[model samples]
Target: MLLTKFDPFKQFKDLERSFYNYPSNNESVNGFVPIVNTREGESAYHIDVDLPGVKKEDIKVDISKDILTISGERKTKDEIKEEDYYKVETSFGKFTRSFTLPENIDIENIEARSDNGVLEVIIPKKEEQNSKKSIEIK
Candidate 1:
């Protein structure tokens, strides 16, 4: 028979690590996570991503089959002067986000725009077709 000791705080620690995206001891953190919001409208679907400090030119939107991917890089500004540092919390790195699109989406008509610090992607839905037909019986 084997015996093991159980710790009560193990679950909490695991949750904290996942929520903060803390890397493991053997891995290195490379990128930041951007907030995203998605909504479905009557005629289209909208994806809004919050990308503060990231320029429009640095962002790229791509689609492959039914997957929509948004990728970009945020560079750190060299504004540190020769003085005592208090606190630095700004994060800068490359980020990529992907979403699986529905079947009715019109890929050719999809469009994206950036205003302020938010990127909005509009995916227009395809028009519904009438497939029912009445046949005259003789």
Candidate 2:
């Protein structure tokens, strides 16, 4: 006898990825969906997001209500004609991505930098705060 476990929402997740035209290949750089990598260490969280062909001036990063947003745009050629190009796969226009930061993050200590079409953000975790309290009875 053999038993197999089934995932009820796997198909739904696949459908959602398809609906948004997410790239099938994880290493595809020309796709509309930029690849993102995140890592957590004892001191900080590191994030690397691929944003090819995007200008540094066009990129924006902000934190609002504990949500971190990274946004940018890639400009396409303006004079290219339909018959001039055989094929095109690069993604253009504005794209935005948001992430919810953990409570341990230090909002003011965050740092970001962009180099060679890749944006890197470093978020340092806040030191543990004392929560113990003594109340006097009235």
Candidate 3:
């Protein structure tokens, strides 16, 4: 039988399990992880992403079926002479973020814009359906 009770400790259990699968420090990973924030409003969903030092033209946003994808590359500034740099910490590379949009979204009405290194994607929700009809008994 399936248990219907909700356990408050489930989150802690999941976090403990994740610790066992953590990546090693020596892993070779490319690109920086752009911070992303998503919020739902009364009529739409807003996705805010931070892409510092990346150009607007370099970014691409597309929707395939119900999946929304955002991709871009941050090119490193002109190569610096080996002796000219004391320390380089800024990350520059390609990065992509994708999301599976829900059925409530109005796909045709989605829009994206960028300003001051911030990208905003607005996803409008479709009007709710209310077409229930009473069937006349024979």
Best by TM-score: 1
- lDDT for position 109 in model 2: 88
Deviation from native of the Cα of residue 34 in model 2, angstroms: 1.5
lDDT of 2: 0.85
Candidate 1 global TM-score? 0.76
- Report lDDT per candidate: 0.88, 0.85, 0.88
TM-score for each predicted model, relative to the true structure = 0.76, 0.69, 0.73
Report clash pairs, candidate 2: none
lDDT of 1 by residue, 1-138 (tens): 999899999999999879777664323366667789999999999999999999999999999988999999877776865354586555678889999999998899999999999999999999988889999999
In TM-score terms, candidate 2 sits at 0.69
- Error in Å for residue 17 of model 3: 18
RMSD for all candidates, in order, please: 6.5, 9.8, 12.3
Write out the backbone clash pairs for model 3: none
Looking at candidate 1, the ten consecutive residues that score lowest on lDDT are 23-32
Sorted by TM-score (best first), the order is: 1, 3, 2
